[model samples]
Target: MSIGVEEAYETAGMILFHNFDIRAVTLGVNLKDLIHPEAEKMCAAVEERLTRLGTRLVRQAQAVSGELGVPIINKRISITPAAWLIEPCPSPQAPLLLAQAINRAALAADVDFVGGFGALMHKASTQADRRLLESLPEALSRTQRLCAFANLASTSAGMNMDAVNQVARLLKEMAAASPDALACAKFVAFANAPEDNPFMAGAFHGPGEADACLNVGISGPGVVRAVVDKYPDCDLTMLSEIIRRTVFKITRAGEMVGRKLASLLGVSFGVVDISLAPTTAIGDSVGMILHGMGLERPGAPGTTAALALLIDAVKRGGAFASGNVGGLSGTFIPVSEDTAMIEAVECGALSLEKLEAMTAVCSVGLDMFAVPGDTPAHALAGIIADELAIGMVNNKTTGVRVIPAPGRQPGDCVDFGGLLGKAPVMRVSRFSGSNFVGRGGRMPAPIGALRN
Candidate 1:
């Protein structure tokens, strides 16, 4: 099916229209204020600040969107950790109470998702952190818009085998909670979590972040795929170079849009996350590009090699364009949101096993994917634990945001709606890991962790 010159030119035009992105710029805000003894006052303060902030986020995002033409996907807010907030409150019930407060404030702000609600126990989970972490089941189950994250490990601190053990158990409990526990999709366990990265559920307003700085998220998988499609016969080296040049240009556009948006919003400018994000739209897929690159299957054989090359090239290129290149800079392969990845599952080209394997070399782990509804909670915990282990050992940032669509069987199409997109229920192994995941203890930080 060789494309004629005219069709190639026309397709190129379409790709450029959608794919030429300086993706998105996001702002992370700290909300240590939300835990005051005067909960009412604290909540009111957050709501007011968020309202004022939303005006800036929306106005600036729209301005940037108008100028860039490539859609800035979301205008989100990430707050200072709920764990820290809960720690000072001195009550196990504090997390749930504060979560409700934050949830309301987020809604009032006209934002999409609000992040940072769990713990950071890379080595130790304080009594407060554990209480907050344990409360996630209730919080996510109770709130529709709040996103949660637990930083279980980091490159400098090594892995928190203990927290991993708890997270595994938490998933099992959450799954049993029925409809709400599935909200775990809003939760992520991160390794090497960055303070300024704008995406969620990992994005958190670190202590270093200003009260309200505007961070940016930039994605252009469609753009990169178009460039690759243009040179179908080119070798790996040539392909890499082309992608580098294109990403450099795209990131420059991102920096320009981000700075302008932040200035208009009257906030300090933050880092640009140069991740190869995707959408449900066709032609904006990393897996599809890999398929187009003659891989035959996206998660088989030379898949990791291709992914390693792709991620490295994207970083090398994006870093060149922006001195502020800082968010989740690696590529993402969240299943449902990525049309090509969903197709691969339908066609039997990608499996959960292979997807986790691919995560070993790339950014995040199995995300927004669907597995058999019959997938036991223990199995789900196992699923998340395994992926986090890869991040733990490899010393990278990896996470799992899997969806077990209630009662959906393998190959069944489940629509999560909105930005979550649709997913074909992927087959999960029938085996059990209950005994292993049930072992609740910490995985000590690896020995190589000297830098923080």
Candidate 2:
């Protein structure tokens, strides 16, 4: 019952395990220096900067991760929002050129995704932003490591009707270009965005951020699920207290790793995102945690309430442990990534409907999970729209990162190989959202939106 933050985590550190720590530390680098108005020079400058930055990040991260025994997962980099870089591009060709440079640079440095091929026009869209919007389909499709995004709304300005409509249109086109439309999953629309979030296909270098910053996203679902499983009959209050203590220990571990890595790299420490992130490993399922809490299954009647309690306790603990706990610091229920969740789905314990409801409390929705290949794009967008609206009205952060597994039907599994995880194609509602999704205006931001 101690209220002390550091002390509580220090005490809990004795039993920290299943939350086996690893972080995806992303470095956001501003690219204004790479823009030269002349396409040739601009392209060269970009390559130089990205190559240098990537090399530096990877080398430093190697030293740090090796020292800490916690893998740095990705030495990825996010650039200044591409909309700013292309504000004066006379041709769509320039964006393609710029994006290619970014992608190659990431590959050259052995990184997975190079983010910030995006536009931020929650309030207004300029012609350049519009052109980048136009070019995104080709940019993401053609570039191997490049990711695209657009910030369409924010709490301060309400939702942007024009941007939302445009993104919906973009989603349809992107879906046609790629069956997975995963390129669109790479494109995020944010509300009340943060300056330093180390995860992507959504992370971008916000305008208000430093020239470059390092944000860390730590993953530890198995650790937590194991802790909860040890106490099958603990009531909600005791459950919350137990979870708070465990998460605080995990957060301290993350802070230790982040600060040490940042110091070795000679960059100021940014924020530690204590997100209950999962991998494609067994024992890493949020659903499994619920099941261990004695839920006969994850998506049953009491699922939402259990999830809400889990979320509140996680935040309360994480907020106290880290002076700067940011990013999507909530539980992730991505079906395919966590082994337990996939089993829950295969066992008829979790459903698409239940997963959608879970997004109301979790960090992201349908993240990298496979859906029936036959699922209509509008229906997909409609599903995404519903989850986003939950965050919009409720004034919390929510996102959808679904992948309609190309040519994969239900009961079939699509393997993304790494952290993207393999998922059995989940069934979708056999319905159409062509009419609903077509009404692409803002769902007027809800009344009494001030919750924080």
On lDDT, the candidate that comes out on top is: 1
* TM-score per candidate, chains pooled: 0.89, 0.88
Query: Poorest 10 consecutive residues of model 1 by lDDT?
Result: 10-19
**For residues 1-452, could you state the per-residue lDDT of candidate 2 as single tens digits?**
85698765643443354546655878878888666677767877888887887888888888886786665666678778888887776875888888888888888887777888888775678888888887777777777788777766555455665566566566666655764555655666665445566777777787877777777887767777877987888788999998888788778777877788777767767888887877776676677788877788777788988888988888888889999798778777777677777777788778888887887777655566667666766676677667666677667776666666567787887765677676767888887867866766555656666556
Best by TM-score: 1
lDDT of each: 0.76, 0.73
**Structural RMSD, model 1:** 4.3
RMSD of 2: 4.0
Cα lDDT of model 1 by residue, 33-95, tens digit? 566755456656766776677657877787778875656767888888778875566555677
Model 2 residue 308 CA deviation (Å) reads: 1.5
